[model samples]
Target: MEISWLGHSCFQLRGKNVNLITDPFTPQQESAEPPATLSKINASIITISHNHPGHNYVQGVGGNPRVVRGPGEYEINEVLITGVASYHDDEHGKSHGRNTIYVIHMDDLVICHLGDLGHALKEEQLEAVADADVLLVPISGGKSVTATQAAEIISQVEPHVVIPMHYHPTPDEQRPAQLDKFFREMGVEAIEPQPKFTVTKNSLPATMQVVLLTPR
Candidate 1:
């Protein structure tokens, strides 16, 4: 599978048979950096984490893609998707509302997308996302989990590869940088950002590792 970070929490995943886009974000005027111009998005499926404008700009995405919103189990185009009910805030949606954690099974690899997860994992949530090959996590603490919380979740999930998202990498006038703090918690000094990432089941590392991808 090929994973391309579009910006913010948006990612375009291309598998053998289908193409999926997760959390497609529209740029906010007050934001420091603008999101990618999502045009000609030939996606077979689009999984939304919540109804927030930055994560739910389906109108901007091209192609008549099937959109999945809430929690459920679905199988489309030979891909098995399981949505686990989660909260966007520690108070169970009282603060930020509900968030959906999507686990996608494709090419014999499990890819989990934790959309704006505000708290640490519970026993049930951990079981639901067991044996994840690739984990897309949020470290911004901007309506999501903090760097310390993210590190704790990583220890619990034990995914083969963890990709940090939803955090600002550079100094932006509109947004505060969070990657530095997250990296400090993870004991990572620096990470070279790549444009995209491609991996298969056989290519997965035995131990957990963090991979940074530059928004395309």
Candidate 2:
């Protein structure tokens, strides 16, 4: 499988001839990269997790991709996409309804996208994410799970690789930085990539690890 961060909680995943883009943001949202500077994208499937602008700017994607809203299941190309229900708040107390976390799987890898997940998972939620080999998690707090909550979920899911996102890495004029807190709570060694990576089934590392990836 191949994955590329597109800043914030946005990421593009491609494998088995299918392309999946998750939680894309509009230009005005907090991002490490500028929207006008983004390369044109053509995804086979586009997923929006919730109604939040940062997670649901449907107009930003350059392609007329088959769009999927939160909380559903479908098959695109050879990948099985399951939308598991979650929340963007500790409970659904803050007028935010439900959020959807996507689990995508192919012959080689199982990838989970924690879409603005606002709270920790129950055992059932953990089981739902069990097949994920690479887990895409939110690192910032408030609207999503806290760093410690994310770490605990990672431990429960036991993904081979945990990729942290949704938090700023540098203290810029936009969002506040929170990657260090995420790393500390991870409680495990993490892989540092040079912004992008390519991997086949044979290239997957043996031991579990958390990785902090930046936008492409």
Candidate 3:
């Protein structure tokens, strides 16, 4: 399977028979990095973590894909997806609102996308994503987990590969500091970002690995 980041928490996960997109954003949302246009992007399935403009915007995607918006279990085109209810703020939905963490099974691999997850996982939530081979986490603190919290989540999941998202650092700003803090917490200095990440079940890493992907 191949994974590509599309600005913010959005990602395109391409498998042998299915293509899925997670948390597509509207272009109107302000960000340090401009998002790739979703106009021509096509997906067999589209998973929206929440109804927010930055995470919802289903009309932006093409192909008339099947849209999954909340907690549920779904199977389409040979791919299995489980959406576990989560929150967009630490206040258990009081501050922000509900979010869905999607655990997808495709191409013989388990991929977890934590959409704007605002707090550390509870035991049940951890169990839901414990089998993830690749974890997509939010490291920006606005409506999601902070850099420190993200590192903690990584330890809890212990996925073979981790990819950080929702962080768009601009020069002369604090976002860059947050990203640096995440790198420090993960015990890394820097990693060159790749355009996309490609992996297979047989090629899974024995130890935890962090990959940085540039938004397309």
Candidate 4:
């Protein structure tokens, strides 16, 4: 399967028979800079982590895809998806409402997308995502976990590969400094960002690996 980042927490996962997009962000009207455009992006399935504008803009995606918005078990086009209930804040949704962490089974691999996850995992949450071969985590600390918390989440999930998201970059100015903290917390110096990431079951690293994907 191949994965491509589409800015913010959005990602396009391409498999053998199915294509999936996670958390498609709408254009930020308040900002002077244009947000990532989702025009012409087609997916067989779209998984939404929450109801926020940045994560749940279904109309922006084409193909009339089946949309999964909350915690549930769904099977679409040979892909198995389990959305585990989570939160958007540390206070059990009192501040930011509910979030869903999706564990998707496709192409003989387990991929977990933690959508705006705002806290460390509980025991049950950890059990649900412990089998993740690839983990998509939010590292920016606005409404989700911070860089330090993100590293902690990584240890809890213990996935073979990790891809960080939800942080600022370029025009935002704080991108480099924010990511630098995450790298330091992860005990890495620096990793060059890739345009896309391709992985197979047999090709997964024996140890946990951190991958940086440049938003498309």
Best model number under TM-score: 4
Judged by lDDT, which candidate is best? 4
Ranking by TM-score: 4, 3, 1, 2
lDDT of 1 by residue, 27-116 (tens): 666654434457667788999999998899786676788899889999988999999999999998999999999999998999999999
**In terms of TM-score, which candidate is stronger, 3 or 4?**
4
Off by over 4 Å in 2: 29-34, 37-39, 93-95, 171-177, 188-193
Flag the better candidate by lDDT, 1 or 2.
1
lDDT by residue (tens digit), candidate 4, 103-206: 99999999999999999999999999999999999998979999999999999888999999998678753447769999999998788889999999999999
The lowest-lDDT stretch of 10 consecutive residues in candidate 1 is 168-177
After TM-score superposition, the amount by which residue 213's alpha carbon in candidate 4 deviates from its true location, in angstroms, is: 0.6
Question: What TM-score would candidate 3 get against the native?
Answer: 0.94
How far in Å is the alpha carbon of 117 misplaced in model 3?
0.6
As a whole number from 0 to 100, the lDDT of residue 165 in candidate 4 is 94
* Ranking of predictions according to lDDT: 4, 3, 1, 2
lDDT of 2 by residue, 7-52 (tens): 8888888676877789887787576453752437777788888877
Off by over 4 Å in 3: 29-36, 171-175
Alpha carbon lDDT at 181, candidate 3: 87
Q: Is candidate 2 or 4 superior in TM-score?
A: 4
With candidate 1 superimposed using the best TM-score fit, by how many Å does residue 180's alpha carbon deviate from the native?
1.6
